[model samples]
Target: MFDNVKNNDTQVSELVASICRLASCMEGRGDAAQREETLHETLRLTYKLEEALNQRNERIAYLDRLAMTDSLTGLLNRRGFQAELQRVLASARRFKETGILAYIDLDDFKQINDTFGHACGDEVLCHIARVMERMTRGMDYVARLGGDEFAILLVRSQWQDGERCIEKIAHEINSTTLRWQEHLLSLKASFGIQTYDHNSSTTNLISAADDAMYLTKKLKRDKCTLSAAE
Candidate 1:
């Protein structure tokens, strides 16, 4: 909204400047040669203003992209993802559609950081991000929700299909290995999925997904413990 106001101010200023220049040219009507020169100067200034406005628009667009994107993985950041989700919700309200939101957390990301510095950890995250992009459909949205957290939105998908898609994504990510220097790094993540419709809010859905992910992680831990006992 502030950007809109700023842009409007710039446009108004340009229009006023152009009007003033034309008025100055009309005021010197007695001097034909001077008026022609002023007319040409005004036309030149108008062209310059147009170019400046175009450049300003391009700059704004670039900044907007930078603001929404995660620098490390080149995926949408949390803010960007929220904006996209809200847009999806608006569409859901209008069309009575449904979608899936999955929250993912790396199981042992801190261990990797503790063992092999932050730089290696960063690279591993990037690799995982790439794997996620490869596994999902073009219509789905992928985002890095800070730290070791990521999210995917299955837009307008059937409930059963969305569940299956998320399950495949989790498996693909778990099985993938990254060769970093002398060590081969494998990452595993816990995922929680929740379906959203016109009635869903962003905060509630994310919170629910997070709870589900934690429960999934607990089940995995319990299974590991039982297997070890055997």
Candidate 2:
């Protein structure tokens, strides 16, 4: 009976050892699986963060462009135009090249607005802006200086080139047709051209261009008044 009891105790100890070993194996596998799942989750989160950052950067770039552009005519706004003019002037001073500036004013724009409403007037301005763009080169800077007033900067050009640009723009504006509802509207622009002098400041150059534009307007007015009298 004693020997039988000792044999039973030995068998029980071996069974307990086997069960402990199995439990250890299962715990090790579970730990490895948990580690792999954690790594995958971390990688997924990292990818999402990078994607969000890229989208934010793209939106910022788009907003910057919109800020520099005019909403009405898709032309450069006054601020952007002024910056370009300053840059060109600085370059001309350094390189000793001739630059030309032209100030453009739409004739009878207010009358158009009064007759056909602001919406039609806006369409006319957009049409003129598109025409001006076609007439000028890629290197030239053209901008709408608020309300039917526009300007062009021609870099490294002679008087002949300036005259050619003016003729092209004027002709195109006069020829372009704006269809507003049932009516077709025609428009004209008066241009003032000034050649930059290396000795002059940017302000002086701009002033000269403005003065020239007024002179052109004055001449047109005089001619119209005389024709009316006749």
Candidate 3:
């Protein structure tokens, strides 16, 4: 990886060196033919320089994607999600739309790991990631915010619609099952949702949704406790 980066740097340096030599030739006192040759060289070097710069830019963009993408599930990492959230907020302000943020925490994920092992845990996360990817539109941002936690953003949506959308998503997630080896593992997640307009800040919005998710999880736990008692 470092070698590839260095090679890109070297290509850029070589193109720049060629451009500098052409500049020196144009600056020196010379005859018309010599000056014409130098001018042609400069013009050719200009295109090469532009091409080199384009390649460098492409490499930078690729690196950025690598930095922002989660390795496990191919979803956006936390940093990427926050950056995307900022963009969605800006877009909402400009277009006068509302954005929805849903924070999801997988229920009893640790126990699943303790019983079935880490490989099974990984399968569960990947399976859930696929379900989320399937459920969302291409434009929507969905990220696994590390370790049984995921976030979803719905742009240009109304509060009621966003609420309903998350309800459906939660149902889909909670009802799903992943068959790993000999066992069929039940998957469940608790979701906390918040609606944001231009007035909302990313930090506060995330915190709000996270808090809501905790509340949802607690309520679900309490309901289960009550049912067991009854």
Each prediction's whole-model lDDT (CA) = 0.88, 0.80, 0.90
Query: By TM-score, who's the top model here?
Result: 3
State the lDDT of candidate 1 residue by residue for 78-113, as single tens digits: 999999999998999899999999999998999999
Candidate 2 structure quality by residue, lDDT tens digits, 1-230: 34544554555455455545555555566577765765565455456545545555566666776788899999999888888888888888788878789999999999999999998889888888888888888999889989999998887889898888787887788676778999987787788989985665778888888899989999999999999999
Q: Specify the poorest-scoring 10-residue window by lDDT in model 3.
A: 1-10
Candidate 2 stretches greater than 4 Å from native: 1-54, 175-177
On a 0 to 100 scale, what is the lDDT of residue 85 in model 1? 91
Single out the weakest 10-residue window by summed lDDT for candidate 2. Answer: 1-10
List TM-score per model, in order: 0.88, 0.75, 0.90
TM-score ranking from best candidate downward: 3, 1, 2
Looking at model 1, the pairs that clash are none
Model 3: per-residue Cα lDDT over 1-230, one tens digit each: 66677787898888788888878877884688888888888888788878878877888888899899999999999999999998888877787778799999999999999999999999999988998888888888999999999999988788998898889888898898789998898899999999999788888999999999999999999999999999
List where candidate 1 sits over 4 angstroms from the true fold.
1-22
